[model samples]
Target chain A: MKLVPLADRVVLKQLEAEETTKSGIILTSSAQEKPQEAEIVAVGPGGVIDGKEVKMNVEVGQKVIYSRYAGSEVKLDGKEYIVVRQNDILAIVED
Target chain B: MKLVPLADRVVLKQLEAEETTKSGIILTSSAQEKPQEAEIVAVGPGGVIDGKEVKMNVEVGQKVIYSRYAGSEVKLDGKEYIVVRQNDILAIVED
Candidate 1:
């Protein structure tokens, strides 16, 4: 099933954390305490104000930093996706 | 103590849920399964785009609906607040 975010919400897929911890240890998902990173996959058109539409600034394919506790978890096509508002995005990874 | 969102994020205070439950029972905070509502208390200036600043569409005093799991929990002045981006705000209560 397809999930469409209403307003300026965006759907993101969690990115696998970097392998090899700073201490040179490989951490698996089970060992991680939190998921703080994700990759943008879909975005909604900007919200409407006075009949005018605001456009979203973030685009698909960007890696972003979001609050470790933000967004609703949904399962789409058996994969987990997060639905978050565009503003919840803290920073975009340049690379 | 005050917490400032870095960008277009907003700080919200969770509102007390209605007293009477739909089933005619009083639902206290403990009885509730989720907190899905809040009131806007502080908002950040919109994010920068192409050297121009985007203004936030939300304002203080407006009640809003957000994803049940959106935002980072923080404490200020002994009160708890949730920091979320403006886009995570789904709807504003008219009253």
Candidate 2:
């Protein structure tokens, strides 16, 4: 089943890690760092949350940088996803 | 200087841990659990935060239960305190 976030939550799919350095040196899997970048998989319909009015600013397919250790991990359909509040998303990645 | 919370933040001082159980059994320091109970030391004047209008619902001197691992620890004047948002408080304790 697909994930449907509620309230101010947003579903995100993390981007793959860069295994190579700028100098074209390949790094091992253990040396790769968990990337903070992700793509919006599902956008929650923003309304009132915790007695405060909230509005969704990002859309599906938009790349974003989220706060470290901010969201919960969910495994669905053999794929991993993250569910976080809209505020946890720090910024939208441009280009 | 005393902590003055900003926005909907609240400063809390954790209550002392109970060293003895209700059964009159005294527990060692390592066996004692960190208490979730705290006394409200300061309350912020609620306003718009993250583009959402918020109103403060808590006041100083109130005893409350806060969420675990929710807020940041701050040290002021050699005193330790936790600074958390209003929503991080789970419930008010009445005695």
Tell me the TM-score of each prediction against the true structure. Answer: 0.43, 0.45
Candidate 2, superposed: residue stretches over 4 Å from native: A19-35, B1-95
Q: Model 2, A1-95: lDDT tens per residue? A: 89999998999997665511221222111111222556899999988787777777778997664544558999999999999887666445443
For model 2 chain B, give the 10-residue run with minimal summed lDDT: B19-28
How much DockQ does model 2 earn?
A: 0.03
Q: Which residue ranges in model 1 land beyond 4 Å of their true spot?
A: A1-95, B18-35, B49-53
Backbone clash numbers for all candidates listed: 0, 0
Among all candidates shown, the one with the greatest lDDT: 2
Q: Cα deviation in Å at residue B92, candidate 2?
A: 41
For A14-54, candidate 1 gives per-residue lDDT tens digits of 77545213324332333423335778987877756323466
lDDT of 2: 0.67
Q: At residue A84, what lDDT does model 1 achieve?
A: 71
lDDT score, candidate 1, position A67: 54
